[model samples]
Target: MQRRLITSVLLGHYLSAFTALGIPLYLPRILSDLAPGTPGWAIGVLFVLPTLCTALAAPIWGRWADRNGCRLSLLRAHAGLFVGFLLAGFSPNLTVFVLALIIQGTFGGAMAASNAYLSTQFKGGDLSRALNWTQYSARLAMISGPILLGLLTAQGLGLDLYRYLAWLPLLAFVLILPLPKDAPKHGLASKKAEALGELPQDMPRLLAVQFLFSFAMVVTFPYFMPFGEQLGIGNDALIGVLYSLPHLVYLLALPWVQKHQGNLLLHGLALLAISNALQFWSVHAEPLFILRLLSGAGMLLSFVGLHRCLSQRSQKGSAGRLFGWFDSSGKWAGTAAGVAAALISQSFGIASPFLVACLAAMAAMVLARPLLMTSREIPA
Candidate 1:
């Protein structure tokens, strides 16, 4: 049963990952077709809306899952995404498209839901390992999603690609159907426990670490392309490879990292800060490639460490609620990161975001110290 559940949720997460990450690549084109002369700010909104909506709505959905069942919440998320995609694919006007994105964000948190669902099945080191697999699916999807969509677009699917992509969530919905029902483990009593301040004290602090890590890392993403261009790496293909390098590192090193989990969070943050700092001076492709590899390695260490921390705390509280807020913290930070990147790049240069990221990573290391130190003695 554990194997089946993990496999199903991972597969479903893969499909969702592909759609969630892949579809955005074409949003600019879609907006151009539906609303010619779309303002730059509106295009910015197009990029940020789904994530912003997801950040806002995740906690509510998570609380609902604690009362209801994870399976139902997962199914509902897929269903909501299906509807959102259908509306997006068939949107006749900008208003409708915006609404579609709103729907998608509000109802589509499959990855977080998957984490919560898996948390119910595993705990301690096993839960960390399980979460590692979920990240694998996500990394694979992130790496392949755009390339596959580019292939489809090259095949002349063009704007209609949006319509075809809508079916992915439906397929994911089917993949989830065979899993045994995951009834609510926490129920309403856990809610009262939390409201009465009876849950674990470390949860909110862990979430702060999540937020800082996410912000520090993602703040560098929006301006990465320009940063690469400035480094004399102008090939689009090469840029894509650079973008994928970190996720590739995760695929290769995550298992080893998972097994050797020690004080990885602090080490990872230090590595991340160093990598980002080094990138500021990388004036050629050779050095930039090495820096990216280091960045990927740092990301892996930190993510696995954080997952382990969250898993440890989930053993003491409601997994669904904890992972829900966990996902929300990252999403909210990610949204802020994008805006901050834009402002920093505009005010300073394309590379300024890296400096900010380095500072943030160091800050995160400080916030993470208490958690990691205490977590060492916790079982699993």
Candidate 2:
């Protein structure tokens, strides 16, 4: 890969991933502030909306990147995200917050633009390493963002949480500023989609995998803390610690995923299924933390593998559309999962969410056939 391409792609991916992470990090505090007496179900929905939006946005942006180019549309997206997420912070009501999420969704897609361009422009394992590091950067944000938000919010910086959140997009924008200029064409898949044009045909299954994979994970999301609280796991501080449990292990798993980067699909899918099964053992509070961490470890593997899968496919060109579509599908699945969790929690209790995840993982193995190797080697 060209030095300029690597630099630009990672710069963009690194910034945007953290930029997106800030919302989830601050969500509990934001919702608690909004609904002092709000039911757990409502808080769960608020926490999930952003992911749903990102899921929806990724494909659109990916397509835009395909037709246009990476540089220009990404800039526009960051600008809008700045406005949108800032608006989310200011939301006086949950409805307003959800609106902001929808708006935020408009600009928030997967990182297909950066990855697609770099893969096309680069050769060898350098691109793979770059992708891994970029993935780690995002995981690193998952590691750091919540801790910083918790500390800062405790310090009273959160009184202006929404306004403060605007800084995220701004910060990411500044980081992306140093990026090399993208090709003169428009960016993201759909932003510049031409008539009769389409992304990879495998896109459907890839996106389906992304959805079910996220379903296996996100099914647990809305209930992570609340279930803990129900089982008396910890107060908010302890809850945050437990909430971050998966991310903690994901850090350790990062190098492992990179080390075995080849032939990741079956292992990733198998691990995902196992994680879902493990969650079944976590119904009570005591085992929840360990179960959650195991789940994260599984996710890191599957996601990196999925990233490898998507990257390899789109290496021909215009990966943004493909990743975007995959991203959006995953988000919708998470959304549907969230909605299901909300409804189920409204009736059965917190364990229902995880039950849903476990089932989803089993179903995912059905479609993972497309991702499976004829043998052990990951095709490139």
Candidate 3:
């Protein structure tokens, strides 16, 4: 039963990566190509908004899933992703295109649902490893999704890339059809809609650490293309290659780290800090690629570490709610980073955001102490 649940979650993760990284692979290149008059910065600015939506929307869907079940919300969110991508493919204008992406982010909040589900199904020792498997699928898709999209773009079949991109998600929808529904549960975990209070006692510290983690990450993502252009690496296909580098590292090193480093939380944080600092000097193209490898390793550590913490500490049957807050923290952090990047880029030059990221990451190290202690308390 546990194995089956994990498999289902992994499949859903794959579908998400197809849309997430695949689009970014081409977006910068497309933005470069499509500036009829609006300048090329539109694509980058809007990129952060969709992710922000996920932050805002995740809790909404998560609480519902806690009340309903992860299985059903997964289906609904997947459907939204399908339509959002499909409509984006046929976007008549940038307005509709950006709007589609926002919608996609809103509906694609299945991640929180998936987290909630796994937290319930697995326990102690099996918990992190099982979640890591889902992360593995996500990592594979992320690594390959960009490369595949790049190949298509390089073949000169470029006129309708967004439309063509829709096929991948559509295929995912079909592939996901066979998974058994989560056995039904009556409504539970739904709090009063008006019941908002001080976040959980641990939330402040956790959110602070997560904010730095996200800031470090988003700095790499939104600036990749602009940074590449600055370094004179203009070929669009190379974007995919660049994006693939880190994910490869993520896949190769994560399991090894897991097996050897019993304290996944601390190890994950240290790796992440190393990668984040690496980005500050990763401006040169070749070094950036290497940094990407480090970045992937860092992300693998951080992602697995944080999730392991939540899965371990969650009260009996309260994993869903905890995971909901977990994802919400990520989304909100991403949003704050996006807004800061927009302001920073508008004022302090292109590389300024990365520098700010460095500053933020330095702070994360200080905040990690409480989180590490919290992880130790989580059940095995």
Candidate 4:
């Protein structure tokens, strides 16, 4: 039963991630088709608005999930995602597309929902393994979704691609139907605890680090294709490969890192700094590909490490709210990064965002040093 639950959740993560990432890979193209004269900054707005909405909405959904059951929460979020994808696919203009993203953001809590659900099922090494698998599934989707979608769209599927792919999560929703339901464990009690001023001590610092990590990671997403174009690579399929190769490396390296999960927070920060710095020098495809692979390694380490940290530190009965706030912080930071990236890219050159990311990563590494020195081991 536990294995089945894990499988279901992992599949959900993969499908949901695939759907979420597909549109972004083609966002620049999609915008050009819908609104021909939109500037890069406006492109940034489209990305930022949804994340801002998601940032605002995650905690609410998390609190609801803590009150309700995780399965019910998953169902609600998947339904919202389905509707949002349909709305985006069928929309007549960019305005509706933007609305679709808003809806998507408002209801999207698949990752947090999955994490909260799994947190109930496992602990210690088992918990770490489950969370690592979740991250692996997401990274797999990141690696494959773009490449496959890019290939199909390149073959003349065009905008129809969105319509076709929208059905995937719906299929995943069907898989979710058979999972055994669990009762809400600490709904009202957790709220009462919060009212009485009981909160995790390390939460604020963890959230700050999460925000910085997200900001550094996401700031370059909207500009990758444009940057590639500047380097003379225009084939969407090839571009997808360039973008995904890093995730591939990350996926490959995850297992080894999981087994030796020592001071990953520090390792992640260092790698992120190096990866972003390398991006500033990557004017060609080969160098950029290598740098992206390095960046993926950094991202996987950071994400897995932080998630494990959160799981360890979560107060009893408050996992949902904790994960929700964690997700919220990342979303908000990502929203800011999107806006900053657009402005930076517009004001400077396309390569400037990478430098910004590099600087942020360095700062995070420095900020994390004290925390790392104080606590070096994952709590058992």
Candidate 5:
């Protein structure tokens, strides 16, 4: 049953990726073709609006899922993605495109829904293993989704390809239809302060750590292209290879890392701090490629550690609400990181965010210590 659930969600997640990250990957081109002469601020709005809406709406969906069922919530989320992508694909003007994004954000949250849905069925190491599988699907999609779109773009299909891709999430919606229902369990982890009544004491701190990790890592994304250009590496293929290498590491290393989990958060954060900081001095692609690989290893460790922490702490009835807020936390962090990256790059240069991220990683190490120690006490 567990294997079936994992396989089902993983496949659905892979299909959902076309509309999820795929559209965002090509948004600039889409806007240029469909809504030419868009202002700088509007471009930012186009980038940030759907994310902001997702962050705001995730908790609401989570709460609703807790009352109804996670399966229903998961279905609703995919449906929203379908509608949002369809609207954007067929949008007649900028207003309609913006509305489409709003609809997408307001309705779409398959990741959080999937997590909550899985949490209903597993706990401890089993839950972590399940979540890790989701990561594999996500990483694979991230690497391939953009590449697929780029290939189509090269073939002269143009923006119409994105429009055609709107129907992709419907595949996910259909895949979810066969999953078993998760009935609501009221106040299952509410604050009665017992082992079952309340969440782990470190959950708030865990969320903060999540925010820092996201902000630090994402701060580098906006300017990575410019940073590569600064190092005289203008080949798009090489840059794409560098960008995708870290995810590839996760694909190869995550299973081993999860099997031998011990102080992963600490080691991962330390490695992440060093790797991010060292990027500041990268004068060529060779060293940058090595650092990116190390960063990928660190990322896998940190993500597995943190997710393990979440699964260990998640009680049966409250998983929906908890994963909901967790996803919101990460979304807000990404939004903030984008703004901060823009400002820091404008003020200091492209390399400054790496240093900022390094500091953030170090700080996360400090905050995560208690949580990690507490996590160690949970039975494997």
Candidate 6:
């Protein structure tokens, strides 16, 4: 039964991620079709607007999950995502598309809710394993989504792709229906307070570290296709593969890292910084591919380390709220990073965001040292 439940959760993430991330692969074309001659900044706005909405809504959903139940919260989120995707698919103009995205963001807390639900079912090494699997599934979706989009778009179905993809979240919703439902429990506030006491003295610092890492990541994400084009890789399929290769590496490496979990925060940070810096010099495909693999490994290490820390600090009853805050922080950071990337790219150059990401990663590494040292003293 436990194994079945875990499988369902993984499937849920995979489907949800495919819908959430995959549909966006066609956004540039969609926007072009809907709003011809749109400025580059508009693309960033379209990407970030929903993220900001999601950031705002995550905490409320988290609190609801703590009070109501993770399963119910997840169901609600998935339903909303389904509707939002439908709206986006049928949108007649950019205004409708933007509204649809906001709706999607407002209801898209499935990942956070899923994490919270699993946090209740496992702890210690088992918890780490489960979280790593969840991340792996998400990375798998990231790898496959673009490839799927590229194939669909190549066949001249680009305009109709969103409508087809809209069914995915509904499928995810159906998959989640068979999972065991958690009942609402009392004393959640007290449990949260207790968890707070168990948290490290510099918990805020860890949150800052998470924010910086996410910001660094998002700063370069939406511009990858353009960046590849700048490098003379014009084929959509090739660009999709370039975008997916790092996540593939990350997915493959997750199990090994989960097995050998340790204080790898600093090392991960160093690698991530180096990888981002290498992007500046990657005018060719081979070097970029190698650097992307390194970046993926680095991201897996840092993100897993942070998530483990957060999970360790959460009490069962309040896990949703805790993970909710973590999700919110990352979302907020992503929102800002999206806007910053657009403005930077517009003013400076297309390549400037990569440099900015490298600098941010270095800063995160500097701030992470104290946390890393302190984490070593804590018992796993």
The runs of at least 3 residues in candidate 1 whose Cα sits more than 4 Å from the true structure, single-residue gaps closed, are: 185-199, 261-263, 376-380
lDDT of 2 by residue, 1-380 (tens): 36665665565565566656755656666677775677866666666666766766676777667666656556666676777778877778777877887776677542544555555455445555555666666677766766666677888665266666677666756755666655533433353344324555666777777778777777777677787777767678787777777776767767756667475655656766776676555646677667667677667777667766655565434555665666578678867877777788789877677777777776777787766553234433
Instruction: Give the alpha-carbon lDDT of every model.
Output: 0.84, 0.65, 0.67, 0.77, 0.83, 0.78
**Cα lDDT tens digits for candidate 5, 193-288:** 223424457778998999998887788888888898888897988887887888899999987888874548788888889999899867766799
Looking at candidate 3, what is the lDDT of residue 266?
Answer: 53
Query: Better model by lDDT, 1 or 4?
Result: 1
Worst 10 residues of 4 by lDDT: 190-199
Q: Write the per-residue lDDT of candidate 6 for residues 190-304, one digit (tens) a residue.
A: 6555454343467688878989998888898868899989888879778877777667777778777866657677777778888888886677766777888888888888877
lDDT of 4 at 342: 79
Better of 1 and 5 by lDDT: 1
Top-scoring candidate (lDDT): 1
lDDT of 4 at 180: 73
lDDT (C-alpha) at residue 126 in model 2? 52
> Which of candidates 3 and 5 is the stronger one according to TM-score?
5
The true-structure Cα RMSD of candidate 5 reads 2.3
Candidate 5 local Cα displacement, residue 139, angstroms: 1.4
- Off by more than 4 A, model 2: 1-15, 24-53, 86-100, 123-125, 182-198, 229-239, 282-290, 374-380
Rate residue 185 of model 2 by lDDT: 36
| Each prediction's number of clashing residue pairs | 0, 30, 7, 0, 0, 0
**Any residue pairs clashing in model 1, and if so which?**
none
Top-down TM-score ranking: 1, 5, 6, 4, 2, 3
Worst 10 residues of 2 by lDDT: 187-196
TM-score of 2: 0.80
Residue range with the least summed lDDT across 10 consecutive positions in model 3? 189-198
Off by over 4 Å in 3: 28-41, 156-160, 170-200, 224-244, 274-296, 315-317, 342-354, 377-380
